[model samples]
Target: MADVQSLLDKGSNNGGCQFIGIWGMGGLGKTTFAKALFNKLRFTYEGSCFLTNVREKSKKHGLDALRKELVWSLLGDKESHIGNAIYPYTMSRLGRKKVFVVLDDVNDHEQIENLVGRHEFGSGSKILITTRDRQVFAGIKVVDIYVLEALNPNESFDLLSIKAFKNDYDDMKIRKLANELTQYADGNPLALKVLGSFLNGKNQEAWKSQLDKLQKLPCREVNDILRLSFEGLDEEEKNIVLHVACFFNYYYDAEDVKKLLDACGYSTEIGLTRLEDKALLDIDGGKICMHSLIKQMGKQIVREESLKYPTWCNIFWIFKKSSEILKKNMGSIEGMIMNLSEVEETRVIIKAFRSMPNLKFLRVYGNLNVQLRNKLNASGMMFLSRNLMLLDWVGCPLKTLPTTFKVENLVEINMRYSKLTKLWDGEQNLVNLSKINLSGSEDLIELPNFSKAIHLAEVDLICCRKLQNVHPSILSLHSLHCLLLIDCKALTSLTSNTHLKSLGKLSLAGCSGLSEFSVTSEKQLFLWVCDATINGELCSSSGHLSKINLVRLQRCEGVTSLHKLVDMRTLGSLDADYCNKLASNLCSKFDEMRALHFLRLTNCSELYEVPDNISLLASLRQLDLSGSNIETLPLSIKHLSSLRSLTLNGCKRLLSLPQLPPSISLLHVNDCLSLETLHLPLMTEDREGDEFSPEKFSLINCMKLDGQSIKAVEASVLLAINNNKAIYFWAKWNIREKELQSGSCIGLHSLS
Candidate 1:
């Protein structure tokens, strides 16, 4: 309520009318919040109206009648003409009056536009709309959008107790049952209220039975309200909802789901957006999530439909049903998820897939038992649907895919850790293929030509130890975004014949046998060649490396210089740690990389000195030269204004420090065993008029530090304690006890 008030205040400052949207999933108390806010602010306006059940009322009486009701409620028996000209009528009649309006449970933008129009009310008029769909305020200039969230655990339990026990709060068994019911409600207020009412006088046994039933089926009242949003969706959107509910909801993210649905020939992008707007599903942190009750409702819908038709189920997630269908060769099944780990001795005829011609999505969870896996191989699964869009079979037992299975409509094929030698005999028309993941397929040695898979975006072949080479046709894929070949030890080279225009990420890390790698993808943003055997020139065409941002070449011993990366003007991070054979002048030309922010050269013992031009990296934020042989930093290092973290932990060579930048907040010189002098940044005023100091300073094993360096460390520690700033300081135990006792701090430590 306080949040809504703040929004209203902000809207009032914008002048004229304000429209604030309250959006969330069903039963999340969207309408309840709007009603409470409406009552609180209604008396402040000259005229106010709260229109409830806007979606249902609009459906029954049409937008025309709802518009009339909105006008009449505000006008209140005043003789004013109302008709198709309500937009103008409201403006003319209520133009000078400050009105407050609340439209509850709105699902469509048209409902709000037809009733209120765009900012049509008089000055100071405020409109509050509660909706399940945020898209309802599409073209309207809403002051703010407040997304109502589910109640927390404490709130859920409190609400449940109020409705169920009515503040009785004494019975342990009933309270336990009530707690379990609250968990089932999952913070939904409507579910809590309905369940609480239903279990009011029921005994402990009855409550347990009710909980069991709730687990299987959602409460009718809650399901009915939630199903309204599902029913409003079109066929494609409904299918997406069901897909998430049945299989992909918790298992896959939005991108994975999109690829599968796109292969199924659905407008996945728009359909997912619609579902998100309707609050039927949420894409939180890329994961598609549906409320527990809403998911139950979707599954129930599919179950009800299956009950009616018996043989024409769209999805089969139940292991028993899927196994039965596969054995019986049911053709009506469009999608199926089977867990082979649960099937102990059931003989599922793999050849029956040929009978299910409509099967589009097939995900089979494999058994880890060696005997069961061999049994699966003995079953001779020789047939697969050519219409399949997604084939996610983990631990596949076959040595090769069935020759009868076509790859025309396949979009994604994920057979990780499978005992497969190859995908197919030759390249088929893979025009619709987008992603292929055969990671952990140790026995796989080759890949089919992807010349026809022009739309392929990702190819993950990680840990495929036997794979020797990638097909040359992959270089022609203009839409390839990511190609990972990590730990493929037999992979010797990845040479491209043409420019990969859309390639953004390419990883050849741990490919020990890779002696050569070259690509012409100018748009490549991330390149990982760690632990490879590439020597000398890293790239054959270094002139086209402009937009590459991150490059990892850890442990690439033969690479002597990073001269090729001088052209990477946009390279922000370079992790070339363990490249011990790199020349001292390897980073001499790194000044040309204006965007370089993080440079890690850990354990690179050959690096002798950093060039004076290092000060030219104005954007460098972190400089990690730990375990390097550099004795001293360039005096110009003080010019790095953005350098925050400087780690020189294991530089054991004799050294004296240079004046450091004020922006250096973390300094680690832990094992610089040789004699050294320290030059910490002076305490000065920062941009915000605060005393600047490094948050952490470590010199644990610097046994040869001069007396002046020790005093400087003590002074900085005292300053940090005086200013009450959080600081960490580590030094040998010879420091003065009197200076340490003057002001105590948390991170200050002494090494004995």
Candidate 2:
């Protein structure tokens, strides 16, 4: 509501035709917001019209009729007959009138363009659009694209309470059930209302039973509305959505899932983007997130396919059903995942694969207890489907794969914490394999030859303690992007002969015995050599280091300086924390790192002062100098327009700080025993529009702050309050009564 009003106000000032798009998932109340906005602003315009369900209306009554109706609504005339040139006719009639128009539930760009021509409305006119497809607004001159988010927990509870109990029921048990239902709905307004209405007069036991049933089946009304988005997807997108709903919903990284899907011959990059744009799936914090109801809707789609012929389902995840299908040798099954954590004992027959020749994806995962591990056995397993594409088995019990198992079609093999001493006797056809993860395989001493796996993109061998050497074939993979070998204690050296053009990330952290490391991948973006014994010269000798964006050298005793990286223009993050052997003057050429955004030099005991030119990193956003030996920062730090966070905790040697930038939003000076002086920009009324106040200010254990410093802190708090921003201020000493005279100490509290 606030967003729409703000846009409308801005449009009023600009005096021009304005268009706004309200977009989100199906059940997020996009239409409700649009309706409220329309009603509130309609009285201010000369004419108003709301076209509801434009997508459905266009299909039912045709676009011509909707266009004619729009014209008649704004012109206040009922036209009997209108010609095919409705675009020009409607524009000519309505262009002189200031109006408020809304097109709700639009799904395609054609509907928008055909109904309302480009910028045809008069000056001071406002047009609002609500849609599930964000692509509908492409190429249109929209002033703002407001994405409506789901309700928060409190709002969801209040809405559900009003609908179910009419704000009268006060039973604690029923309220608890209502809270659980709201959580299960995942803040979706439509699901909350549906569940609330269904359980209006039901008893406690009925609510519990309904909740239990909802876990496996979504409400019919909610499912039908949400499934409209799913029904519009293409076949490949439908398959991808089902894959996430059944297997990878918030369980794995989106990149890993994308790799697997791409290997299955789907256009995953574009498909995932399109799904996200449609709001059926969300990629949050690098994980695929889907609403609870949407997930259940997708799973129900698959369940409906197996209603008559149980063996014809495309995928299975329930342990009982998957086990039954496997035992019955259901050849039509394409994928199955079995989690063994709930089972006490289970036995797999090795010959089951011979009957199910169509299996493409198979995964077995669980934290098997000691008794279950001993009882569960696959000792005689000898055959696997030749058409297998993905084989992910956590805690695999096999010592080696069966010799007859073909690897020609395998796309990914992930067997973490396995008991395998080796993968196979020799290399087989692996042309289609793209990823291999054998991390935590302590007993594994070597990797299989991957010379023919030309498409392999990632290989992870973290914590493979006994793995002494990497196969030479791995270095020749031209398509490899990530190679992680963290904590491989016995691994001594890694040398690459040819240039790996596609390699991007290489990590050798915790490899204590690593002495020699070299790579020729000029396109590498990240390199981690933390806690390793590799010589510093090896890093400096890499001619392609200039292209790397991040480099971690923590606890690297042999390193004395980063003078060698003076020319890395692309380096954005440099972490040299706890590098005790680092020289006081680590790197004097900070001006060369034009792209540096994060600089962490914490616990670098030998660092006495930061380079004066450090202020030249115009893109730097975070600077951490905690537990260092610096006494004072350069005054030029105030010139850093992009720095937002500064950490100076445990800097016992520091005596004072300089004026920080107005962009700084966080400042921490905890335990700074020698901190006697502090400098801050004075807050005044003239700087209202330009001020950027700190959201968090910490002064714990800084007892030496003088009276001037305390006053500055108080003024900063008042400024933040005036800006209507939440501020977290922590101080160990009691604030003076004079400082609280203006009520600036409302949110300030003592940490002591």
Worst 10 residues of 1 by lDDT: 681-690
How would you encode candidate 1's per-residue C-alpha lDDT over 620-639 as one tens digit per residue? 99999999999999888988
Q: What are the lDDT scores of the predictions, listed in order?
A: 0.79, 0.78
Give the per-residue Cα lDDT of candidate 1 at 140. Answer: 82
